[model samples]
Target: MPVRAVVVFLNLLLLFFLGPSMAWASNGPAEPPRPALTVSVQQVDFVEMERILSATGNIRPWQDASVSVQTTGLRLKAVFADVGDVVQAGQLLAEFDDTIIRTEIDQTRAAIIQAQASLEQATQNAKRIRRLMGSGAVSQQEADQILAAEKINQAQLASAQAALLGQEQRLAYTRLLAPYDGVVSAKSAILGAVYSPGQELFHLIVQNKLQWEASVSSRHLSELETGTKAILHVGEGVVEGTVRQQSPALNEQTRQAIVYVDLVPSPLVKAGMFVRGDFKLGTREVIVLPRQALVLRDGFYYVFVLEENNRVALRKIDIGQSLPDGVEVLSGLVAGDTIVVKGARFLEDGDTVRVAQVAADTVPGMASVTASGAAFARAGQ
Candidate 1:
């Protein structure tokens, strides 16, 4: 009886030791320490996306021409065209004193006549020397000397004629003629005032072809291309333009590239003004999440994702530009993954979450101060 009782006691002790261990082995891994997180998760998707580049810059004339007087120290006899005048090509816009210039021209003509007479006499003398050499009336050495003298005279006559032509051309330049058919944007010369060469007399712009010259941050260069459609903000309307060029050089101050867009012919537009422009590159489909859903920590972005076991895991994500709906995730997540869209700031790693959808639809845009969190708004205040 005693041995049996001892055996019974040992059996009871073994049962007590092994039962707990069997229960522990059946449980497997321990439950994670997850926080109570409430959020709305979204599935990532791919759709058509159009990249845009926006910047502020000034408008300018495509063919801006500055007209200046080429003749120096000439008295302005009269002014024919004024500012805002639409002139045709070759039209005489202004005149300078021709009194002294005309006299110079006459003198040049007299000099030309005198040179021609000298050249003719030299030619006749040379011909006579050649005939004398053939007939042996003059020695070969003497005929050669006469021919050299005739050539010298001929060179002198040519030099004199060229000077005369130069004087005649100067007389013609005294009259300032319209360089091209353009509107007079500016007029600087005064009546009867003597102006020097290269003095600003007028400013002209070509009749058509206006340009929206904009400087954009170099970071945005990839978003723009030649022939890309752009909208130029005008006074009260938007003008359409096609990007003509994106300069490779960057501005020193702003570190931006100069972009030129040619505007369609518009009656309401003029050059030398300010404007805002936007260019569309192309479209892309990507996974987008709201700016509010992102949790920035240690120079990286993250979003809380719910796993199948009903637990939340901190998911690191690569984010791009802010969009109207949400931020585009460049990587780190795929479609059909549930991300925490709301109450993400209050959650931590290994947090447990209950997924719920909100009635209000949201997209990625700049997060408003009031929308970040109550704590953030208070700190700013």
Candidate 2:
């Protein structure tokens, strides 16, 4: 072949092979496409939270009283009080049959009247005897006898008066009265049932006062003090209480002490109710994130943090209290760090994500991130 023709063909072949590669060198590599998953972001923020210690306990009355009668061998005529009734101190609760007691009182009163009359007559006779002794109309021995009879009459009158007072007290015992203002907790007196002395007929919760007695481990006892605030879970609601006292000694077997919390009066609270409560020890400032932002994988908690270029970086976080507001982030996060709140479970470390604007009404203490609606739609698809 001719030299000129061969040179031309080699140049053409080189151009053909290297043309596309040379053109690609003029432009940078194509930008990477955004990830398809859509996610809402929330900024970590500081929240003032209360330090709480949880404990379980039961509700009980602060003071209990057993109402009974001192008189024995009496049949109950009427029971005016029943369980769950609120009564004032000295309120009539029941009555015993007082027919025999009233009769005895009347007879003693009659005897006292007779004794008083006889004593009056003896006093007049003693005065006459003194006058007669001076006139020699009566001997010294007879005068002494007359004075002694007057003394005997005075002693008899005193005895009759004492009997009358005893009968009156016995009559008063026929009625049972409340010892204090309280709620009736139990009743044992039946209509027409005979009662014995000191036998309990009614049980009362004094002043309707109740306390929550919680068994707290000795380790946490020091953290609590009188007037410490606590909240009790009562049914579907909660009741506030204050630490009124603590047991000085711990249980020998359990090594736990009783913390008595005086609860605010609520109709829902009742003695003998088992309940759970949390004591508010103090407050602290902590970083927290929405619970949905966390992903649990292989027994570990992780979150997808927004990094530069709309990429996500997976971070392992130590979580503390899981509050109703948010999950407390103990470590691996800071104030003002953006994290994926929604759709975090579908992401991996270093994954490019299409950031979507969360609703304007975000969690308290969190800032909202904004993005184009078209990008959000494409990411959703």
Candidate 3:
């Protein structure tokens, strides 16, 4: 072989072997920079939280009474009050036919007048006979008989007066009056309808006073007492109430006890309205976190906790009662734990995060993010 040809073949062989090594040396593995998320963080702590017992109930009148008629076999002449009408005590609610009652009263009065005249005549006659007997013009037995007739006439007069008074009472009964200050809830008596005694003419809610009848579990009865405060949710409004009474026995089917809470008057509340109420039993120690820190995923609750080196880890938590400011943390957390309050929804487990704001310690179990900590978050926005 020629020397030049031999040299070219050796060079080609060397190039083929060095090409793979050179490429590997120039392009080696490189680490990519981790994506950092700017977020706000809060420090959570244990708090003295209220232990509230929840229950459902209905709004009812505090003093419901059925206004009824006292007289029987009287036709309803007029109805003065209708349903939803506010009436005062002794206010006429309905009227029965007073024609017969008045007529009887008039007849009794006439009878009384006649009996009075008869009594006066008998008294005069008895006096005259007694005087004559003293002079022997009348016998003693004859005078006694005259006096007896006088006594009978006087008795008849008293009987007539009693009958007239009774008839007057019956006449008053023809007008059904409100027993108390109340709002008429129902009316069953109709005009010209003959009603018997004790028949309910109208149903009244005394003074329009309403109450919440809450059904509490029998197990929680021990925690309740008269004068305990309660909060009722009625028609998008909140009503304050006090524990007025409680049932002595539990409902056989529901295993619940009825608790009556007298409510303050509110336009939003009405009788027979189904409502929900919360009874504040007492306070208890519990871990609390801001509501924004909680994340709901697949029906589970989670929060992003700030780990060492500014890294975040997704943590599951068990939540208890919800409060006006925060929620109760049942488990899976401890005091002094840092959690992402804002911008946690866009983060995942092990994600690197830059804490924009660290909340200040203001309220128990909750800390507000510092103004400086939020600088980065604001800038990002």
Residue clash pairs of candidate 1 = 47-285, 49-283, 49-284, 325-363, 325-364, 326-363, 326-364
Question: Candidate 3, clashing residue pairs?
Answer: 356-373, 357-373, 359-368, 359-369, 360-368
Cα TM-score of candidate 1: 0.63
lDDT of 1: 0.75
Q: Which tens-of-lDDT digit does each residue in 1-381 have in candidate 3? A: 999999999999999999999999889987754757888776666667778988999898999988888888888988899999999999998888889888888888899999999999999998898678769887888889899999999999999999988888988998888999999999898899997788898999999999899999888898999998999987667999999989989999999999999999888898989999999887987777778889999999999988766789999999988888778888988876778887888988999877653433333333344543332221101
The C-alpha TM-scores of every prediction are 0.63, 0.66, 0.66
lDDT of 1 by residue, 1-381 (tens): 699999999999999989998998998897775548656555455655776667788878788677778777779988899887888878888888878877877877787787778778878888999777778799888888778878877887788778778877877877777778788888997888988888888787776468888888887787777898998777788889998998879989879888989989886667777778778777777777767779999999998876755467898888886677667789988865666667888888777766543332242221222222211111001
Candidates arranged by lDDT, highest first: 2, 3, 1
* Candidate 2 error regions (>4 Å): 1-36, 51-55, 99-172, 215-219, 233-238, 250-256, 276-278, 308-311, 359-381
Mark the regions of model 3 whose C-alpha exceeds 4 Å error after superposition: 1-44, 128-144, 252-255, 281-284, 289-381
**Candidate 2, residues 56-105: lDDT per residue as tens digits?**
98999999999887897878999999999999999999999998888888
If both were scored by TM-score, which would come out higher, candidate 1 or candidate 2? 2
Q: What are the candidates' C-alpha RMSDs? A: 10.3, 8.8, 8.1
What TM-score does candidate 3 reach? 0.66
